[model samples]
Target chain A: MENMHLDQHISKQFNTDLEKLRTAVLEMGGLVEGQLADAVKAIETGSMRLAEKVQETEDEVNQYEVNIDAQCTEVLARRQPAASDLRLVLIVSKAIRDLERVGDESSKIARMAIELSDEETDPDGFVELRHMSSNVQKMLNAALDAFARFDVPAALKVMREDKHVDREYKSAIREMVTMMMEDPRSISRVLNVIWSLRALERIGDHARNIAEHVIYLVRGTDVRHISIKEIEKQLDQDQ
Target chain B: MENMHLDQHISKQFNTDLEKLRTAVLEMGGLVEGQLADAVKAIETGSMRLAEKVQETEDEVNQYEVNIDAQCTEVLARRQPAASDLRLVLIVSKAIRDLERVGDESSKIARMAIELSDEETDPDGFVELRHMSSNVQKMLNAALDAFARFDVPAALKVMREDKHVDREYKSAIREMVTMMMEDPRSISRVLNVIWSLRALERIGDHARNIAEHVIYLVRGTDVRHISIKEIEKQLDQDQ
Candidate 1:
């Protein structure tokens, strides 16, 4: 009965700590999603104020990362969770880093948006940019939702959607390069678009990484450095 | 005496495990440094053989990351270290990821080198690329050496040198853009150069990240998401 009582106490403490970590991560996820959305909207509408707002939120996001990191370290040191619980802590820590990076990437796009708002508008590629931005935002939202629910299928879908983001980025780059080659005077403006597009592409990568962490947590396997086809096969086998 | 013996045993085991982890990280670091060297040489000499060699070493680098991650997880689970020891483990894990990514970036440069080798070599940009590559390699070496010795000054120096890499990258991009604008016929080749330059820039960023991890390990302060100026001020106060 003494052993049973000790196990009960340990289990209760671990669950409470895990819950706290989850809440903190989700709160961070929500803030990052907001920053990403506002940054994209700023670019779409050329709103300097909105862009500045996104930049201002970066400090808050950074604070979340530090706090979440501390919480994870505390949970690890104090709780000593093992197996799936341990994996949860590890993946939560990893996901927080990716989320923080998404925030950073959004800040980059916001800075570019602010700079581009002052220049003459070029609507030629803005439509594609909006499309790509919305697509990436969707992936991030899905990945965060999957994390909140621990839904592996949702995470897999997020991973698969990243390829679409890549395709869009390539086509956009091709278009931007062609524009720059056609009009030398617009080189600097087009270069800003190129940099902003790269930021969006990197944000997509961070979202994919979050989704990968979710899969790793649930499947107890490392799917990184492997082909998506291989990952799909493994998922199928697990199913 | 019984309590003292238990404490000694735990301390010995933790020290042994940490030493093992450090050796694994250093081994991974050495392989990554080799890959970076070969990748740069391939670009400089336009040698497909050297590029392929870098590609071959990628698997070995990936294995090291996997092995080191397992070791860290085991140490956390079995020993449950706290305080600075815990921070060391966490920072070591983070550093290993950065080192692995540096390997990935080198592979990217290698693939670009192989593709560019088939085309007529442009010696004009090759000189700049060589300079940037060597500078980045030096930064990586310094960062790894700092990690090995836990030397804060060397890490700070590595962080400072990243600005030089950035200047080199920007100048290279400006030259490439000018070349593309002057001769639209060379757009494809110039695009390749742009991609290669971006990869090198990313490598410098990874080196900076490693230096930041070293700072976190030594000073127990998170230096990321802040300006180097702020970090310098904080370091001065600490001293």
Candidate 2:
């Protein structure tokens, strides 16, 4: 009976630990997603206030990262999880890194927004750059959803979306350079827009990283820099 | 007798493992340093050949990074080191990350050099930026020396040198912007220089990261983003 009671206590503790870890990661994901949204909105609407808010929220995101790191260390020390649990811990560890990079991209966009305050006019800045932001925002939202649901298909969709962001980013850079060539006065403002778009593209990559981690967590394989068809084939072969 | 034999085996294995890690790191360091120097020369002398060499060298650096990562894992699994050893292993992991980032910066500079061929300006075009690159190269060299000697003072000296890089980086941005404004047609060529300097600033930062890891590994304390005086006080207090 004593042994049975002790086993019950340990099992309960392990479940609680798992739950805590899951909640922590989700909370971090939610905060980072919110920051990404704010960053997009800041650049989309040219809202310096929104940019300031995103900058402020970075502190909270950093704090969450620190807390999650502490929690991972504590859980590893206390429970000594094996196999699946160990894999979960490692996935979370790697996910935190991706999430932190996302936070960096957000702050970088906010910085561009702040720099945008001195801007005047680029002919099609909004139509071109904000369009790219929308695509990147979609990728981020999908990545976060896949992370929440552990949906491999949704994760794959996000990975596919990154190309659109990258395409738009390069196009935007070329367009901005031409604009600066045509009018030197537009240099700073156009550069600011180009920088924000680049940041958005980087944020899209970070989202893809999260999706890749989600795929790895569910499938025990990495899908980085690989096509979805290749990943699916590998998954099928694994079975 | 068994315990003594075990100790002898452990010591022998530790020596071999440390040697492998050190050599890999030194090799990566040397390769990245050469890449950066070649990248700057390519930019200065308009040598696509030099740029191509830097690109080819980056592959070797990437391979070194992969090998170091596996070695770190194998070492960790074989010898569950404690305290100082643990610190050393973690610091090496972080240093590897820094080296990889430096490789990335070198590649970026090389790419800029490749792009420069299409828009070659007067040879006087990159004087300021070339000086910035030289400063970055010097810092990187000193940082590697600091790592080799485990000299905290030398590492601190490298940290203090980041200010000069930053100062040059900021002034170069201003000068580049002015040049673009003065001649709108020059925007494309000047943007490449701006990007190259930005890459150099980032490479210097990676060197700083390596220096900080060195300080942490030897002292068991994180000195990142903190002042040299604080690091000195910590070391003094420790002794």
Candidate 3:
């Protein structure tokens, strides 16, 4: 009876550790989301202050990743967690990496915003940038939510949305090329806008990667390097 | 005595698994290097055959990542390695992610080569592309070599080289912008070259990332999100 009670106590402690790790990851995700939103708004409003704020927040995001990574290592070392618990720790490790990269893309966008704040803005590229930004922001939010809930269906939706985001990115690049060709003098400025658009597109890719991690976490399937259609078919077959 | 022999046998098996994982990663690194070389050559010589070969190799590269990742997980689950052994598994996990990304960048460069094969060649951008390509390729090779030997000094050198690559990338972009402004008609073709240059620059960044992983593995310190100077100081203090 005493052994059984000790086992229960240990199990409860382990659950608390896992719960805390999850909360830390979500907190990090929230920080990255806010940084991305500020970056986009800075670009739209040409607010150097907001862009600088994003830069400051970047350090915080990095610290979160480092801290979360340590927690994961501690859990793995102490618990030697098996099966689902092992998967959770591994998934958190990979997801934080994606989140850190999303933070990087956000910082790149913010830098572009700062560069364009002094230069004459090109309205054409911003139309595409703004559109793409909104799409990626939603995708990232949904991806984080899916992770929080282990919602495979929501993750699948985010993966499907990535394809559309890729198409939007290609069309936006084409439009930028045409704009640069029409006004050669605007080449440098338009190039910066193109970079901002590129950053946004990459953010979408990172979000898709997070969504894939979520699917892997919940379904115990590796969904990377496969098409959304294939992933969906596999999930359907599993059912 | 029977139990002692059993322990020895299990330890030997674990060593074999770790050895196999390391060799697989090196093989994957070698494949990615070939793809990058082929992609660069295809751009320089306009060889659609070589570009297609690179595309074919990408699937193989992706498969290597999946295989290595599974091996890492198996080791972690079975061995529950602590201290240095645990760090080795984690480093391999993170390094493979960087390797997979390098493969993606190589594939992107190959795609740019295919696009440029049809268009009229622009010699100016190719000069910078070739220069950046050679530098990144060397950095990647050095990084992998460092990982194979667990050589921290070699890894540090690769990290230092990354800064030069970034500077070169910036200057190349500046030059490309000038060429586009001078010959607006060449904008489309030159843009493809710019993309290839960007891909090469990103490859250098990934190489640096791999080098950082190597440093972390050897030193048991997280060297990410820190400047090279800071990393050096930290290592010096430890010594």
Candidate 4:
């Protein structure tokens, strides 16, 4: 009976540690999502102040990445967790990396926002920027929510939504090209918008990465280097 | 006496496993570097067949990433390696991800090579592209060499070289913008070249990432999210 009690105590401690790691990862995800949203808003409003805020928030996101990585390392070393527990730690570590990259891309967008705000371009260009931003932000939010709930279907939905952002981005790029061709003087400003659109498209790619991580975690399979159709078929079998 | 013999055998097994993992990582690095060089050559020669070769090479690179990840996962779970061994696995896994990204960017450049072959742009632009490609490929080669030999100074050199690529990229972007402004009819072709330059810049970033991983692995430090001056200072202290 005493041995059983000790086993329970040890298992409970591990559970606590695992929960802490999960919570830290989710918190970092939330912080990245916030930075991304503010970056989009900064671009739309041409607010240097909001862009600065996004940059400041990135330092915190970086801290979370370091902290979570340390925690995962410690757990892996101490617990020697196997099977599902091992998988969880590995996935969390990998996901933390994806989150950190998302934060990096958000900072890139924020920097572009600051530069774009300094110059004036067609306000019509921003309508496309706004559209792409919202779609990507929604995809990122869904990815995070799916991560939180371990929802594979929601993650798959995010993957599908990334295509829409890609199409929007291509159109935005073509539009910018046409605008520059029409008005040569607008070259620099249009280039800034083009770079920002590129950043947004990359943000969509990062969200797709997070969704892939969620799928990897829940399904015990790696969906990377595979096509969307193959991923979908795999998901169907998993279900 | 038997226990001592058994201890030696277990240690030998671990050493073998660790060596295998390192060999795999180095092999992957070599393939990525080859693909990067081939991609640059494809652009310089404007050979569709060479560009297609780079694309096919990416499949092998992707398999390396998946295989290396599995080996790391298995080692972490089964060996439960501590301290330096654990760090080795972690760093190797992270570095493999960076290398895979480099391969992806190379594939992107190769695709651009195929597209740009059909269009004529300023011959001057090719000069800049060639300069950026050679510099980045050199950086990547140095990074992989450093990883193979665990050479921190070589890694530092690669990190410094990344800045040169960035400057070249910025200048290239300016050149492309000027070309677009001077001849609007060249807009589409210049845009393709611009996108290809962006990919080269990202390839530099990935090389920087690999360098940072080497620094981390050799020195037990996290040089990421920090300035180059700080990294230099830290290296001085470590030396």
Compared with the true structure, what per-residue lDDT tens digits does model 2 show for residues A102-122?
887889888887777656653
Q: What TM-score would every model get versus the actual structure?
A: 0.91, 0.84, 0.95, 0.93
Model 4 bad stretches (over 4 Å): A1-10, B1-10, B121-124
lDDT of each: 0.83, 0.75, 0.88, 0.83
- Evaluate residue B208 in candidate 3 and report its C-alpha lDDT on the 0 to 100 scale: 96
Provide a comma-separated list of chain B TM-scores, one per candidate: 0.93, 0.92, 0.94, 0.92
Local lDDT at A185 for model 3? 82
DockQ of 2: 0.37
What is the full ranking by lDDT, best candidate first? 3, 1, 4, 2
lDDT, residue A176, model 1? 84
DockQ of 3: 0.75
What TM-score quantifies how close candidate 4 is to the native fold? Answer: 0.93
List the candidate 3 regions with Cα displacement exceeding 4 Å: A1-10, B1-10
The DockQ leader among the candidates is: 3
DockQ values of all predictions: 0.52, 0.37, 0.75, 0.69
Find the candidate with the highest TM-score and give its number: 3
Candidate 3 chain A worst ten-residue window by lDDT: A1-10
Tens-digit lDDT track for model 3 on A42-76? 99999999999999998899999989998999999
Better of 2 and 3 by TM-score: 3
Better of 3 and 4 by DockQ: 3
